[model samples]
Target chain A: MNDEAACVLFDSGHRACGGCAAAMAARLILDAAGKDTIVVSSTGCMEVFSTPYPETAWGVPWIHSLFENNSAVASGVVASLKKQGRKEKVIALGGDGATFDIGMLCLSGAFERGHDFTYICYDNEAYMNTGIQRSGATPYDASTTTSPAGSCSFGNSRPKKDLPMILAAHGAPYVATASIAYPPDFKKKVEKAVNTPGPCYIQVHAPCCTGWGFEGEKTVAIGKLAIETGLWVNYEMENGVVTKVKKVVRKPVDDYLVGQKRFRHLFKPKRNDAEIAKIQALADRNAVKFGIDITLKK
Target chain B: MAIGTGCTARPGKSRNNKTGSWRVFRPEFINEKCTSCGMCRIICPEGCIGENEEGLPVPDYDYCKGCGLCAEECPSEAIEMKKEEK
Candidate 1:
């Protein structure tokens, strides 16, 4: 391995699709967290792609548990490390399904206990590992396999669960949102999360080419659009206070929604202004909630 | 499958799988066009990009999956995607 490759903790191989943002997120997270860290990955695309039993990509110590028990497993790891007096960082990685839905109970319990660990949720917005099933973190009006838009229907009827706020409500010292579009910012947040001495949570918006239905190459662009359109806000909360947020001039939500095939139904046959307006309203609400809009003076 | 020490395997053993065969479009690094911004290196999903001397980016095609991310996200348009002959 070259010096550069030696520095990359998450080595290439295994099997993530071309242009997978989750894969990029995994690499960046490991890069920021460093080698003195143990990652507990829940069952998801990341877990499936990065580790295939005998062959694994991770250069650091890594483990995989059940789908909904990521935090529970991480809590156990943290306890064992403390008992041994070993100082290795523990990071629990989960997809949206594992973090936002099925594993919420375990995650809640872990946070309440205040384990000295960091939990990173690669929020691809759906269960990409299991054929694009709708998840709790699925944004409002996205066409998932379970929530396909059809006659008398607009995509997913519910909005994305405010997971960072929910975790922050548990009195976590640090909770933040991130995206693959901004690599340095995401890496900085990861570093912050690992250094913080509580159950810090960071939900990174990883655009899925297969699920979200965009060209593989456009993954980073799509992530950038999500932030610029105010659908996904990158903000940090420390002790339940908004410490920092990535502000944008703000583009119409349509620019972000128009490209993804999941939102194709919104444009075809006729432009569903009403549905698009509702989606736009959701972005507006996020902009207000996070104060992400930048007012250009003069 | 011989499982050792709680079914342990060598770290970074996934490197055995050459993923370059998956590429339909290959990125040709244009030295003249490249300003060595290193955007392709940081943004590569596979982490297959390496830095040569003088800080130029050289992608290890053995694992480059032809995601076109480097070309698409290139600030100076230094990397161009060409149809893979092989």
Candidate 2:
């Protein structure tokens, strides 16, 4: 394939932190979507970085709206384009903070209305742009600015709200969870979402560097580590049945947490082994719940 | 500009069976600025920093999270964060 055509979707001048996984995900999805794509971005890191006033990293038609209205805006774009007889592909992207939290109503409305668009959530697990605040996508027991571990608290007390399930419940034709760590699988999912009729949603696990308190260069490594540890799983749902895309087996949660300072408190002497165990159990439960082959036990 | 060792680069593969197989990014240390201090080793979340036989800091990339804590905390600006090759 021509890399130049793919390269034009997102320019290198965007302001995302060094090695931002969302940038990589945006690049890959827009590459697969090709040149005739129109992207509607929410008020998140991707939006702020890619379209900073005088400069825009997006090569295709791009729009930025309120934090929670990216989906609705894209739906409007799709409607306007349809009315104008424009067949160009339409995509809406937002972080989990926007999609699962602030923008839930708008997103749900768009999905329920069955907008002919693809809504991709770059799930970095928090509102990284506005200073690593907790969102609905933040995993339980993980510390965030909003959920700092303290004398009286155990980090975020609630499990990450299952977003793909919510989208599936909206009767979306396609919904999938992807990670930048697994590119081929993510590409396939993107292609599927683009081709599927009606509304589609793909939540990509884009590991953050600056917000996660790690070096910018570890984007790809952290991406893979996330999936290996089951904190982020590569899976898809069609008609509400979840299926794991077994590119690799699950790994220990500690293997994923050791790199980021956000989880540093967990590793300290107070040693919330129960919290860590809960996270591991969540992974195990997902494996069993979704038929993921642990591919271990030797 | 090559930051770290690339001998075991995975190319298209994902898993590496060998121990210390995960991509190792060697941190660049400016000896003139380093004071034989241990801050780089202390802030390392992965516990990958080690002292060489001579007591200089060395990053064990096999377990190093690539978090760059050493680079951030170096008071003397001695550690330059470099990515180890795959």
Error of 1 at A180 (Å): 0.7
For residues A163-271, could you state the per-residue lDDT of candidate 1 as single tens digits? 8999999999999999999999999999999999989999999999999999899999999999999999999999999999999999999999999999999999989
User: Each candidate: what lDDT?
Assistant: 0.92, 0.75
Under CAPRI classification, how is model 2 graded? incorrect
Clashing pairs in 2: B9-B86, B24-B84, B25-B84
Note the DockQ of each predicted structure. Answer: 0.64, 0.02
Q: Write the per-residue lDDT of candidate 2 for residues A1-298, one digit (tens) a residue.
A: 3334554555444555545678668877876788888888889988886666555667788778898788889889999989999888888988989999999999999999999999999998898889989999998877899999877887888999998988999999889988876666788899889888799999998888877778765666787777777667688888677654654577788888888888888888666788889889988887776666545667
True contacts kept of 2: 0.00
Off by over 4 Å in 2: A296-298, B1-86
> Ten residues in a row with the worst lDDT in model 1 chain A?
A1-10
Writing each residue's lDDT as its tens digit, candidate 1 over B4-77 gives: 77645553388889999999999999998889877898889999998888888888999999999999999999
Clashes of each: 0, 3
In angstroms, give how far residue A132 of model 2 lies from its true place: 1.2
